[model samples]
Target: MGGSGSGNRWRYGIKGTVDASKRLDIRYLKQHGMLRSGYYSLSWNRGGEPTGNINVRMVSGESMTVIGKWRRDASEEWQPMEKTVYLAHTACAYGGSRSWFVCPYCSRRVAVMIIDAGYVACRHCLKLTYASCNEDMIDRSWSKRDKYKAKMGGDKGLYLKPKGMHQRTWQRLRHQYYEAEMQGWQWAAERFPMIKDWM
Candidate 1:
């Protein structure tokens, strides 16, 4: 299966069976994504000169080598008589694009509104940071700090301070929760950049 992501990012998933004795090769396909970006390169020892290109080889007669590989079109057929390579192994290159999200505290991406008063605190950081003004779909209630503490398995009021709650506490809690959750995500992203990218 293959699909396109936000901002025209492309993705492809290959899954099938290959015959080992038919001399069938699904190789010689070059990836246009990586070649345009100049991030990854591929070559073989059997060739004369190195082309710094990428290809996926399906069958090899005797593990031959090539000096350099040339960029090829990916829309070709896999043949049995041809000794080709596949370039569909290129990795993703997002170019620092943003992913969509929805949360008051999360400044990265906001795609939807959350409606949960009991966990007004951020699911990520357990901090009260967001404020929900609209009550079209769900009830807006400021979850007491005690309740949050109880749910999180900590001492009573140890993690919460209700000193200066706004009159619209529930609305504000949504905001706080979103903010705290986003911060927590940011921290986690710093620790594991690849994991954060996938998330």
Candidate 2:
């Protein structure tokens, strides 16, 4: 089951794809006024459970130092890791400015940075792909359908719109949900002929 055959077809390499969901967004920090000369803690959670966290000290428009403990893999012991990530600002079209993190390895400006191999870097430098990239059409469609369903305030079915949502918006979302649902069913039926009967 662990061989490099069919079982591991979707498995990524040793330093698996960096999780985009768990990232440091310079935009978020700037918007929340966290880009100041102070200390902050960044954390991540999975299903209401704490997974990991890091401490960041901001130097306001210059750079931010990240302090955390990380390990390459489960076999190795966790080690203290500290690195300073520089910041870059670009002018926006309308007005004001936007912030980005300068990738430590490539020196590219990126809005989000992920921790990989005990260091923080942009996704490109890490050569990582998103988990959704390995998903098939059926999976993508199901995800979209579920997202719209949840927006309408239920997971079982799309019957009524959630309160405070406009009629036109609800109609649009319902149509989108139905389309995604049908697409998911179509793909599933193609994979398993028996599923066509239920459809």
Model 1: per-residue Cα lDDT over 1-199, one tens digit each = 1111211112232221111111112122122332231233344332465323333232222121112222224565432221212122223386543222223353322322122221111233232232332211112212243344443344523445455654466445545654554544554455457756666
Per-residue error at 99 for model 2, in Å? 1.8
Name the lDDT value of residue 98 in candidate 1. 25
lDDT of 1: 0.30
Candidate 1 TM-score over all chains jointly: 0.18
By lDDT, the best candidate is 2
Clash totals in order:
38, 0
**Model 2 lDDT per residue over 4-86, tens place:** 12222244553345564468888788788899899999899988998789999999888999999987688999999898999
lDDT of each: 0.30, 0.80
TM-scores vs. true structure, each candidate: 0.18, 0.74
